[model samples]
Target chain A: MGKLISMEGNQAAAEAMRQINPDVVAAYPITPQTEVVQTFAQFVADGRVDTEFITVESEHSAMSACVGAAAAGTRVMTATSANGMALMWEILYIAASTRLPIVMALVNRALSANINIHCDHSDSMGARDAGWIQLYCENSQEVYDTLIQAVRIAEHPQVRLPVMVCYDGFIISHAVECLKLLEDKEVQEFVGEFKPVNSLLDIAHPHTFGPLDLYDFYFEHKRQQIEAYGPAKQVIVEIGKQFSALSGREYGLFEGYRLQDARLAIVLLGSAAGTAKEAVDRLRADGLPIGLLKLRAFRPFPSEELIQLLGGFEAVAVLDRAVSFGATAGPLFTEISSALFRADRRPLLVNYIYGLGGRDIDIEDIQKVGEELERTAERGKTEQLVDYVSVRE
Target chain B: MRQVLLAADTPVVVANATGCLEVATTIFPYTAWRCPFIHCAFENAASTLSGVETAYRALKKKGKISQDIRFIAFGGDGGTYDIGLQALSGACERGHRMLYVCYDNQAYMNTGIQRSSATPLGAATTTCPAGKLLPGKSQNRKDLTEIMAAHHIPYVAQTSPGRWNDLVSKTQTALRTEGPSFMNVLSPCPRGWRFPPNETIKIAQLAVDTCLWPLYEVVEGKWRLTYRPKQKLPVEEWLKTQGRFAHLFKGDNQQVIEQLQAEVDRRWEELLEKSS
Candidate 1:
């Protein structure tokens, strides 16, 4: 049994981290993501958790420390936002390729160039190819639940890779909501003691990590990293099943809301999904053949499952919170289109880039997008392949 | 590099920065190191070892690891004095029980002799060529050992490889000290400094004799000169030994050599005053 309480998303993440209680947590503060570690640091100071909390100098050091600690055979975790994640970019790949199971909480924020700190998918979307298992959450509850699940997913025997739990900055991170907290014992039993594959502390069986691969083994090592996703994709689903059993909250690669029997649909990820759910309901009530596809796992793409779920749609509008610049479509849209490229019964896909720099996406906005998607279906063609929404003229 | 290893009687876990030490020893599937080792990145060896050391303390507090082990991080001057300075500063300020040794080869020796912050004045590097308009690297080398001392760590030392006994002793003292020890050892490079391979140790010895690279330690904020020359050699003794300084012997470059010598003498006097 668990207790229900109202708390902000960052506090919820901290509570989950307290329950999980990793051996080491090396983190630096960044906006929106700051309270997550700040609360966790309080837990450490209060002796609630015995984690070796290293207040590193920068995000680069934070990730570097995580890499070193993970390779040193300790369960490690961290949290950061956009520019901080960008700072950790170089070591992010190292953590994955080295097969170190380090977990990170990424509160998504827009990247800088005029320097903004607001909800956007640009951060984690930029790291989509960094070889980490990325999990996006819709609300505070999901932020809490996904963080705990992230630990097991990262440390699974078959999947020894880093996990990034992404939630929208300020939207989900600062917004207070009622969520259930798992008993500490329950989390402890679920994650168990981390069984490391290699330990730098093992004096007898010494191992060398991150060796110079050069021409001989670099490509093969990368091939191994690629093959790792096979088991990783399975482990993610399998652990979701196990988590559902305990928590009674079912999770999947993606969640389809009123999508099964619909002809027109819109796709999105992160906190905006909650807003879209109401729009989906309004569209369904109006007798429009409209539905919603809220993606949870962005990495491993859920191509096969997405094809089966979305192939019957007449037209699908993929809403992306981040633009892909010169690309033909947004990142989420690009992935969705590529996943459906060879589908036997694919829908006409249009991309809508929206809600950048924390711009609000109201239910009416989603309803309008759904109506446009409905019109696209009625016309039997996309009016435009990619366009912006809710922006100044 | 070998002296630091020999000084540690116990087994050690090593975190190496990306430089000659890491590249020369490791080449996938084959390594010269028998101990557990990691080379994370060029600019993060200190933070990396800090992680390892923190993990050791955490696990050991729980009675998990039972080994009497030491943690060591190795970086070159490029990684230490320049690129990785922030990480090194952070690690030192945090005060982890580890030894960070900068094998001070003066420049980015592994990258075709680029001028690093540790490159001495008037020493020609590819980035600061000794051309008609230029007179080699114009800036004096950074006083990195002093910089580490400012952190007020338990141990900070400066030594060179040619002084085998002093190098080994300094390493032993550093390892024995409790928190955050640092060593900036002048690891004479034959290829980058343009000296004969056999004269590597001789070049290092000349550096110390000329007070260009002195052997000293700052233990718990108290500075001490570890080794002092019986009869101090002129700075020209060090400059003449390395081909990188060969241009100082060329026409109208005498003023640059004088400036270099004056910088060395000023630093030596400062160290002496601090020791006194």
Candidate 2:
């Protein structure tokens, strides 16, 4: 055991990065995620973390710099919020496709238009298909815990891929909680040092990096990238085991709260899951037969785990913070519906698009959703409910 | 261009097509063009050229490549002024230290007198055939030189094939520069221009004499004229020499000729003001 301290989620994330002892951290500061990079910058300045902290121009350049640095055989890390993540959209794909083990922390926030600077899963949801292993944290402890596991998962020899650790903006990034901080030497041994087989700017060896692919072989490259996502499951499990051994904090692709005998359940990701869990506890006390299934690992999206968890529940409300606009449903809703479609006995999946553009969703709102789900379970009904908990006349 | 190519002691790779400039400079195995040039074909030049240049730089930085090779991409106007623009922009903006030279031959003479972007306004080509209603191409040639300069590179210049020594000297200066440099030279094509093949050099000289294409250099944010025509010839004289401009001599077509002359005058005045 190292030290138990009360700290904000951003502080936990920053301290975890320091303990990991990364080689290069290229980042641009944005709201919610700003403090993560700020604290890390201070660490670099104070001789705490001896790393190349490249203060880049934009999130695009930050991600671009990460691609360059990581490709050059350096362990790289970065953090960003909504628009910052939007700006990094291009090179994020580059980092993933090139198989650079770059770790990015995304402070989930509402995307834009009548902008709200608060918590939502909008940022990470948009990046779901970017070939990155995405992990969502519920609180400050998980923020610290997941970041450690993220590095191990991303840099695994079998799965040399980029990873995005997402914790809700302001809710998890700003909210304070008790966290178990790991020792620097302990984390250093756990993550170990990164050594690249090929890198840019290496004088010892000559190699071609990032060649433009035409139609002739571009599909095969992408097909191989898709294939890596499957192996990532094993890597994530192994890293989770290692993290539990080192820090006494257990992690899984998905976690359940009273979900074993659940007839009605609310499925969600990020900080909202914490509130859903609280709602589940209250409803469970009232003998409401409700539960919460919090998705921890969203990409390489744990389909089997989801089916197994939801299979027991009668009706499931899948809450998504992103709108896939003009589609039949929300991004997460479409995913859940598709994943459960082929099952012999599937749960009645309801679509709930909530907290978009960071509108606040309280415990009451989650309770309301839970009550609705319970009613649906009782009725043995199926309905796609969207934009729930709306302010009505 | 020898001044530019020979300035660096190491091997200088040149990517060129089988155009007038390539034919003039290189002959089979008894190659005249040197700086240890690796001659690449036109269509796939940019990508492969970049591959070679990047490999060399990465190798040299790692102490793998023995000689300090200065890579230069040289091609006709058809190559640099149009087809290769995308790759050129990528290379220059990506901070490659390669000098890209466009010997503006005015037409695709290598393929048979077809029109290219570097072709002058009112010049006729197989595609831009002159007729009763229209004289030739109404639009003026695109200013590729300025476009290269806009990339915020260290060096970009507009030299004339008429001034051979100056062209060679500027070519050398660009190759020695640390970053990407682009040079566009107006090398008149005799076959395309409907002039005696021997008059190729003389007509090219006349191009500068007539201010048809002025000789200038854009260096370190300063624009300076290297050659100023003593008597700016009427656009008619340059037009009359080229069979492509034969239709321009007809009635009402003279207004189009005047419009072309006026645009030239306006540009020359702007260049003079900039030179100051």
Candidate 3:
């Protein structure tokens, strides 16, 4: 039996990484996410983890080192957030495009200007097309859970792709909660020894990576990248199931709370999902037939599962933490809307852009949004559609 | 069209990054960049290539990778000199059994002609655009040969495509070197330099004759001058041929030209002293 320990999400991610026993943990520190690397660095310092902890100068170098370390044939890991993640922007695409199974823990934080280091989804959402398999965590448990699965998903022979496990800054990153720590032996068996497909370091059968691809072959190579998506989706579910068996917790591409036998539901992802779930519980207590759909895997989005889940609901309040600027709706909202395009009886979806730029997202705010959705259904009209939920003027 | 492919007796993987070498070599699919060579294109090829070399070294240490396989970074000047310098420095300093081949085209030609430290004095690039007040660039070319040489590295060489025999020979020598070796090749950019495509080799050769670029090597702390001109040509001739330096002679900055020649002479004398 595993011992239960209360820890913050950042610690959970760092602990999960430690248990994975990566060869290199090259990372830099950033706000709301600093503790993650600090914890790992301490682990390296104390000789707790037999890994090379490359404390790089900047996020660019952190990722640069990861590329080097990973290409060198060692299982490598790193963590960063917000401005730090933005700094690693150029290399992030390379890590995925090159198919290096480098895993990164992205502590989700808001981008600056107004300057905030609180919970937000803008950072990861900005890197949506970077080609890495993006996994969003609902809470600290998933933080510990997803990280273990991320390694398996990323290192799969069929899906040699980098993965980013994102948890909202401050919200889940600093929020203390109970996390079931899996045994190191179990994780070692689960993740296994990562034998890279065409590793740079493999001298027995020397194979060159990062070749000069001219215009003629660039597009086809990119198309081949698209082919990995299907395999990646399958691997995520497989790893999820495997993880669930090892640890007594259910895992899926998505989790539906009261999704069945409910006329209306609130669709959410990341740490905000917990807040939404609380709102669902509160609404249910008052005899409201409302539920919450929590997104676990984001990259190869579970569009079919989303369509099936929403098929029964009369309407969906897509609580998106990130806005698409000039687009029709939020990033998650847009994807959900498109997923429901072929539905036999489409639910009236209301896009609610909330918790933006590290704003505090109280469960009461989610309850307020739920009330709005209920009113939208009852009056056959949607007021304040595609507006900030509980945002202070 | 001519095609060449060969498999090594041992596993040999080459990591090439995006630059002129990448663009010129890889057109892909139809003219697929694929070769008997297991070539990978990394964004910052120097670091990526270094990573490949490091990985190979670690594997070799563990008896995972074969001892015979060659690990190399087919990096461009921009990738090696500017963008990926730190990684290259780390790899070189660590003495990884890797060959860092820098196709130094003088400027960041991949992203459009911008002045890199490798760009020669008085070259008109997009960044150092020609104007009435200033004649293109005013800084001297950074002696990367000296930079790597200072690292006390086992092997470092300066080669130019102008001298193909020397370039290929330098490549061979670097490959033969037991430890980390860097080959900085003067890969002439006809497009960036605003010269006729046919003049690529001629311009490269002229660069050497004018002492703008000298062919030499720093092997195990010993300097060896590979190619020296019978008669040192005037720097003006080398400058006048390329449109990038057209503004230099057209203006009253004859002093700048003289200053450039002086620095070239100083460097040449220093190289000669070391070679002797």
Candidate 4:
């Protein structure tokens, strides 16, 4: 096993950064995500890591710098929250299209309208189509492990795409938790040296990044990028297995708890999955065939595996901390519903948009979801296909 | 830029903004650049170059990169003067050893003549059309050279492609500077300025002679005048050559011409004082 220590999500991410010792880290400060860069800056200042830390003016510049550095052929990383991630929208596409393997630590927070700095997946879910691989962490330990794996997954030849490691804003980012951290040498060995394929400094072989593609070729290039995601799914699984062997903690695209022959299940992302697991255990003790499936990799969504897993369940509730605005349900709900559409034996899927803007979600709230799922299974239909959980309404 | 990289005899990386230069030169399956070039986004040329330069430093320290390399960024007025100002200022203040060159074409020519902060007063653009209600752009152009100089970088210059020798020399100086450097070049856009393509250089020369675009440099906080008109021509002489400013010469818009002339004189005097 690895060394065990207590640290918050942001600090743990920074600690993982210290171990990896990236070549460049250009970041801007935003709430709930600032501690990651601030702590990493301390390491840079104390000469603990050989990193070039650039405190950029804004999140747009932060992502821009990362794109430049990565294109120049180096391992680069950054961190940001809701509005900050929104600012990086344009460059995020460029980073991925250019095939720059940049890793970003994204602390999930609600996007601004009423200006609430709380936990939500809206920030990352907004960038789902930006051609980035996204991993959602449940706690500090997962955050640390995911970041390390992100570097490996991003740099893989078949998956040279940017990656975003996301955890809850304040709930996981600020709250301390006891988590196992790999030794510095172990992380260094796992991440290894960054060998750039087409470095900007390689004068012998010149290349242009982010070229303007007209109608004649833009479609083909996009098709090639789509093909690249196929290998990315395989790479993510292989990396997860390798990480599992190293950390003694198993990981997959998603985790299943009491899922064998489950008549009812709750499918969700991030820390809320922990709460759902507790509800599952309590219901199981009362002889209810309930289960929970915690989604880890939202991007490169494990569609086939998910279809197979949910196929056996009679009723499933997909909880999302973000809304799709005008869509039938949230982003997760839409994807899950579409995935199940292809399944021969489809489950009665209900969408639950819950815990937005950092609203508290307790065991009772998840237990209520389980009870509702049971009723939906018994009734053979959902009364409300799309509903809100733990809201004033 | 190709010439500068060729002359340097070292590895060079260029970061370009999303504008005319980037789009015109780099079409998919073909590229004008012979060296490593990157175009991230429109408003982040400087910041992107800063990252490339920072990576060079890190790699050099780790013995991964043994050869010397230089970094440069190019942006248009729209990218450098307005949307990209914050990032440019940050890159300058952070002291990245890279040269940021803004080709001031006065307006967003790539987007078909929209007004930019570098569009001079009384100059017509699609956004600031010269019509009965208004003469042209109501405000004076931003002095980006002065703004860059205020950053106290090692080198800052305002040159024109019309003066080829001066432009080349200033580019060399910027490349050789130890710290951050900035160059604001007055690159005349024939389509946007509504001038004959053949008269691009002549119009740029007229701009310099009329004191509309001065040839000057600021080195380590000290300003130096590189060229001064023997006898400063009236701003009307330069304005009349471009159809964008042709509306200013109409009988009803003569007052607008006077206003532009006064603004030009004020800025010329300020430049003279700073150089002295």
**Stretches of model 2 off by over 4 angstroms after superposition:** A44-48, A202-205, A383-387, B1-276
Per-chain TM-score (chain B), model 3:
0.89
True contacts kept of each: 0.67, 0.00, 0.38, 0.84
User: Among the candidates, what TM-score does chain A have in each?
Assistant: 0.99, 0.97, 0.96, 0.99
Measured against the native two-chain assembly using Cα atoms, what DockQ does each of the candidate structures obtain, in the order listed? 0.83, 0.08, 0.30, 0.87
In CAPRI terms, model 2 is classed as incorrect
* Model no. 3, DockQ: 0.30
Question: Which sequence of candidate numbers ranks them by TM-score, best first?
Answer: 1, 4, 3, 2
Worst 10 residues of 2 chain B by lDDT: B39-48
**lDDT per residue as tens, model 4, A103-187:** 9999999999989999999999999999999999999999999999999999999899999999999999999999998889999
The top-ranked prediction according to TM-score is 1
- Estimate, for each residue in B1-276, the C-alpha lDDT of model 1 and write its tens digit: 788989998899999999988998989889988899999999999999888888988898889988789999999999999989999999999989899999998899898999999999998999998999898999998999999999999999999888899989999998998898999988888889998899988889989999999899999999999899988898899899889999999999999989988888899999999999
Whole-model lDDT, candidate 3?
0.79
Query: Quick one: ranking by DockQ, best first?
Result: 4, 1, 3, 2
Could you give candidate 1's per-residue lDDT for residues A116-155 as a string of tens digits? Answer: 9999989999999999999999999999989999999999
Which 10 consecutive residues of model 3 chain B have the lowest summed lDDT? B1-10
Off by over 4 Å in 1: none
lDDT of 4 by residue, B1-276 (tens): 543454454567889999999999899899999888998888999999999999999999998888888888999999999999999999999999998989999999999999999999889999999888988899988899999999999999999878878888888898889999999989898899888999999998999999999999999999999999999999999988889988887869988888888999999999999999
Tens-digit lDDT string for candidate 2 (B225-253): 88888899877767777677777787778
Off by over 4 Å in 4: B1-9
Q: Where's the lowest-lDDT run of ten residues in candidate 3 chain A?
A: A200-209
